[model samples]
Target chain A: MGNVGNVWAVVAIALVAVATFSLGYRGSRHASTTQDFLVARRTVRSRRNAAAVSGEYLSAASFLGVAGLVLKDGVDALWYPIGFTAGYLALMLFVAAPLRRSGAYTLPDFVEARLSSRPLRRVSTAFVLVIGVLYLVPQMQGAGLTLGMVLHTPGWVGALLVAVIVVVNVFGGGMRAITVVQAFQYWLKLFAISTPVFVMCAVFIGSGGTHGGESRGLAEPLPPTFSAPTSIDVTTPVTLRVVEPVWLSAEGRVDGGSARGPVFWGPGTHEVDADTKLMFPGGAPVPSVAGTPSTNAEWLTPTGGGTSDLWTTYSLIFALFLGTMGLPHVLVRFYTNRDGKSARRTTLHVLLLLGLFYLFPMIMGLLSRLYVPELLVTGKTDAAVLALPGKFLSGTLGEILGAVTAAGAFAAFLSTSSGLLVSVAGVLSTDILKGRVRDFRYAAALAGAVPVVIAVFVRPNDISMSIGMTFAVAASTFCPVLVLGIWWRKLTPAGAGVGMTTGGLCVLGALVATTVSGYTGNWAPWYLQQPALITVPIAFFTMILVSKATQRSVPADVNRFRLRMHAPDPLGFIRDRDVARFGTAEERARLAEGRHRR
Target chain B: MTTTEQKPDWEEVQASPDFVLLRRRLRRFVFPMAGLFLVWYLLYVLLADYAPGFMSTRLFGNINIGLVFGLLQFVSTFVITMLYVRHANKNLDPVAEKIRNEVESRGEEK
Candidate 1:
């Protein structure tokens, strides 16, 4: 099982790597100017740009994370994909054309131009860097997880390999090549997921498939518990092993109360004395295992409702939908188009491509629930898609499916890592390093290196949770800035500065608390876990209030900037006749007078 | 006689036929598409939030109504784009060419 099919998978993965690298190299030929490197010369057509956006946006999180969540939470988890796609819809309607029309390379650039202040630009840039780095962590972690699971390599080695490839491709081709690679990966990923799922479904139906039915046998319900294994030292490799399953029934209380009921221990169950629980993995309390014989379940099955569950559910929706608009990497892609019209069109295309790509992962997640539930108990749920083919299908068919999944995983890692590196590099080249073209090349390398180092030092436990945290942070900080900066004319520099700092610091503080608190405790833990439900609205309100308080000091050119943003281009639909009706003529005449006086 | 000479007529500066057609074509296509897309996207968000049962009902084995609704988000986007391209090609593009010709002709007239 280990090497038999894995060899084919590796060959397939390498082929994808070669294809992506070639596409990137070809893109490099077109990238002679700095603008070409940064924004694809603003010539990207809507359809291709949409594909590229979907490719990069899908990430390992969408590829593995949503499926994993659906497996854990049932139908409720579909909201993640819904929210994610909807965010783009929000962007298409409100932000896309306006953002592109703003003619800025990044969010910070928009801020500076809008507010006409360097300090505001600096503040926004810092927020972008923070969000970019936080976002990069999950992508790096996902790469490690995917590589380790598929290729059976050490996680760090996998992470490093991906980092190197991303750095090289990004440095060589910049945005132009990245666009091609990402667009190709979107379709590659589509084929990878769709092909296997379709084939699997056909096979399942052919084998006299029937939907799952209610369990009739008497089996004790398994209590959810987390324990670290004692045998695996810090240096020792972590691998999955089957222990005898344990089943415990609480007949009565222990220590002071009633007598407890009898418990059964069976295959695949693990047990330890209550006091010896600390000796279990991570020095955490291990729950007494009750052996239960249950049919293997699909990860996508929805469990019945609970009270505390709804908050986490809503928080997930809010974070994914609202937070999407602020992702530095995602937003930067919209800027690659030639004009606002193209940007709008590209966003529309992205919605379609993303919607199509999402279906396969959801299918895979549900299928794993039915057939390959063993992986969930083993804590390697991320590999459910990769592991499914070998379990249900075999021979050449299984091997080919395995190979395709591996290739898609590699594509996922590379496309996402490239998008992150591009954002980081943009920040460094334009904002932090403030270097020229030659310096940008060096800055790009450094940008890639910093994240790899971060990836090495900190390994997140849950890839989905880590990505969610990044989203929370982005929503809290940049979401406010973009929303307010676009719609609110009174958003003064001071207000933006305060809102960004406050929101960024608050989200960062919550992240630090979540990390230090070790995801435990009572109310504080929940708040730290999902801060966006509160933090986003607070940031929005704070920006509005602060801007109003400082309205007297608002820049005089704010109206002019707004007009430029909302005004149709000369070639666009708004002609002199329309302008006259819309009062744009008066505004333009005033602008002309002001320019004449100047 | 020289003192009584009328001021040169600015209206006599001939307008190019191409420029007028280009402006007219742009007015017909770009604005309508932009407006249509805006409505389509807003409708998607509202449907996703409120229509949970519709989204969840299965269309195929495990493929549900909600999934189709989500996928339409993409479909509508492509559909709008195709519409935009078709409109631009048939309506706006010729007008733009006309506008270009008019601008060039005006330059010659001057």
Candidate 2:
């Protein structure tokens, strides 16, 4: 099925964009000055803020990539969503209230204010930008994959489309718009995603969930089979493994040579070149993409996911759990809470919303194994959520549900892109481009264009793995300092700077080594893939040891700062001095008065 | 920004008995609880990674110990949230509110 764009899906996607834009335009009335942005933040109650956080946090990775991984690897893939959600719990317990009360917005801004070190601020900015930009690549890639699946266009078209939309919205300079639009997206996604799954479940029960009235065993010791005559368009070169010899029809390059139309595969791997088409008869065992488990029993086991072992699994857990507090967009949004208590409450609500939302994607992933296992064969498991709706239902009803999933997927790309793009732009304009020029709308556009351009050059098959790299960076570099800075009284600026620099360089080296080596398999060295296990502990120790050596440099005002950071908000000790550090005379006065009122 | 030689209000509040008690109570709840959850999650990950047989053992129809462990992560998270909220409301919020009211009425530490 090539280039068969569903009209219903296209229309539904358009509706989501229109809805987002109109709501943002309405919120623009409250967003003129930077102070007005703070007002908009404080005025939003925890429930709405939580929804917005849930909306922005659930990117294409959570929406599509998790299901894709589940399809490729078996029970092991459940850890992706669980790790993603568990991070918020750690944040709520440790970072939320204290960071909010500290009165600094971004992680870079927080460290700069807390430590009074300009170099550290610059280091922090590099991380925020690197993590922000690197994270955007997967979202764009997922968008490309989704559009390629639904609209039947080339991949680059979807990446470019999202880049332009996010840029224009941010250049308009209305954060109130993003907050309002993102909150609405949460419910939109929840409804759109769950409806098709619920419908499919109902249909499954009515039909007895079996084809030809046979009792299907989920754990049968054989590879999946095509229940019908199926044709698949292979967009990329792949090495597929067949469990047994079978006769098939082909229409493109096969086995490293040009082929007009006939195929027979032996009991091993066969190479299928890019832009090939293959036809399989009913009851043919699926020739799955190489490097994945072929049988149900293998898929169901935890260790059977190709390259997973104890070290990699535990390291991945560190990246997911400790990394939440270090994400710039997520941490910055938490600061928008009215106070520390409000921040804690908003986080709790976010945990609930995310916990409930993850269940649908997990369910969809399980259902995909039954109805859309061919996706595994094509290495396009990311499209399982969107395509399952069409595969299971065969009429206009299926088309309508496919449209809803497409719309939900589009919203996932849009909301996250907007948040991350604005964050990168804000840092660029403030720190990098300061005093160079007046307009930072140029910075916004610059930040917006870089990721899609990179996405065009490289298409990593696994979106979750790409995001896991960012999480590792966050966990290694910043998770160390944030945990230490808040609790360790003797942490000096020099120690923090050195520790962060060391951690960042180590993780970057691993990233460079892995990319240059061009090894993307489960069997690659665990240290290269899961560097956080080593880097995080090193980051913490460096900070502690260096602080011990530089004992005299601890700020004399540590007690005062701790009091302001940890005291109850109703006591009102903080005077919001961060505004004075980087605000206009008028804005500073307004912020002081605002704090006084609070 | 102020670097005063004379003790500031922060020092007074930091030394106060109520604030001391408050810090002690807050740390007691947060540190051990954070440790507990982290340890519990670590155990689950270890089992999934090292002890695959235990995790993959079929518990019922289409349900395995692995799937149940994964779902229990969600259930444990929800439970933890409820526990923290309840603990804070009952033990922490009242004392914090009382301190805030006293400080506000008395106009910044005496």
Candidate 3:
């Protein structure tokens, strides 16, 4: 089937933009000072801040990639969402209260303030840049994929569209606008993903709750069959591996030879060139793609029945569980809370919200198996969530639901990309541009520009895998420093720097090697693909060993610093008493005194 | 920026019995709980990775042990968070506030 017309998609995109900017404009009224731009003046309530965090954190990875991974890799990919939400649990337990109480606006700011070292701050800023840029690429790629499916336009159009919108939003009103905009986006995404799934479930149940296909026997390795006459237009060159000789009506290049109708394929890999249309009659089992399961049993197992699955699985868990605390955009949100208690409460709320949102994607992924199995051969499993509405329901209502899912997908890119941009711009403006609002505008431009350039050049094979790599890097590098610096008083600046550099370089080298070598199996390929399992332990040891070796360099006031971080804020009383203006002069004096001790 | 250079009397506060008690209480809750949660989470991951047969074994109609384990990750997180909040409020917060109040009130005179 051709894509739904552009009118609905354009309207949906316009509505999301109008709603986002309108909320931002309202929030901008309160945003005047640099503090307002950076941390929303520390005035946001726990519930609102939680929603904003959930919104910004979801990104296209959760919105589209989770379901996509589940579709392609089986139940094992459920770890993506589980690890993602559980990371917050780790944050709540270890990082949330302490980081908030430290009173630093950015990760770099926290590193510098905690360690009393400007050089460590510079190292952290570099990581913030790398993670921010790496994360931004997938959001851009997801945007391109969505728009190409919905609008029938070139992929780059959607990427450029999101980049411009994000830049303008960040330039106009930094963190203040982002907070309000993202809070709205969380609910929008929840509604967009769930409403359609709920509707589909209801319809399925109403229609006897019976699936539309015959059950395959346990001994069968048969490919998935088209329940109806389905015509697939290949947008790019695809190589399909057939298990048995099958007949198909074909037009354009098939097996490097042009044929018009009734082409036969043998039991081997066949290349279908770009713009080729392949028509399969009813009950013709779909051809298997090069790297995906062709049967239900294979799709249901978590490991995809591969030898390297165990190592990769543990690595993903390591990366996601530890990585959430180090995300620059996520860390910056805690600074918007009124205090440490609010930060903890906000994270709790975030855990709940993220848990609820992930459920819908998992449902969508499961439902796609029954309705959109052709996606296996197409290698567009990412489109499963978007394609389900149209495939299962054949009417105007289905088209509308499809449009709504597309809009929600766009909203995902917008909210996440904006959060990342604001964070990157906040760091750039503060460190390089001296924290001026005008300079922030320039930083905002640079923040969005670099990722857009990368997105335009590199075509992502799997959006989720790319994001998982970024998480692995973040987990390996920053997770060590934050955990050690907060809990260990003897952690010197030199140790922190060395640990971060070692971890960062190792993960980066793994990423580079894997990308260059192109997934050559064996020789510890899974370790390279998911580097956190190896790199995180190495970094932790390096930090501990280096800190032990350089105990004399530990900041002398580390005891006082720990006291400030671990202490409960008695001013929480004043904060509750006066929500609007709670950062009192007395509290400032106390903070100033505590800082002096450090 | 200016706050980084100050020198408050941290040694005095760290020596106080109240501060010592507060640290002890916090460690009691944080270390054991953090350790427990990590072990639980790691067990789930290890089981999923190594014991795929156990994980994929269907416990109900199309509802396998793996899916249940995945959902429990969410259930357990919420439960842990609530438990920690309760534990902190009862055992940790009052003592922490007491220490903070003592330190801040004294620092004000300087």
List lDDT for all candidates, in order.
0.64, 0.78, 0.81
Please give, for residues A279-300, the per-residue lDDT of candidate 2 as tens digits.
8887777878987877777777
Identify the candidate with maximal TM-score.
2
The better candidate by TM-score, 2 or 3, is 2
Q: What C-alpha lDDT, on a 0 to 100 scale, does residue A72 get in candidate 2?
A: 78
Better of 1 and 3 by DockQ: 3
Q: Residue A490 error for model 3, in Å?
A: 1.0
Those runs of model 3 whose alpha carbons end farther than 4 Å from true positions after fitting are A210-223, A235-245, A250-260, A263-276, A304-307, A519-524, A570-598, B1-8, B108-110
Off by over 4 Å in 2: A2-5, A212-216, A251-261, A304-308, A434-440, A519-524, A578-584, A587-598, B1-7, B98-110
Q: Compose the digit string of candidate 1's lDDT tens values, residues A479-544.
A: 888867876668988888888788778878888887767534324656568777778887888888
**Ten residues in a row with the worst lDDT in model 2 chain A?**
A33-42
Among residues 3 or more apart in sequence or in different chains, the pairs in candidate 3 whose N, CA or C atoms overlap within 3 Å are A76-A302, A596-B6, A596-B7, A597-B8
Provide the interface RMSD of candidate 2 in angstroms, 1 decimal place.
5.1
Q: Is candidate 1 or 3 superior in TM-score?
A: 3
RMSD of 1: 9.9
Per-model TM-score, in order, reads: 0.74, 0.92, 0.92
lDDT of 1 by residue, B1-110 (tens): 11112222222211334433544454465447546654554454444445544544556654555446545555665565566556645765455545434433544454
iRMS, model 3 (angstroms): 5.1
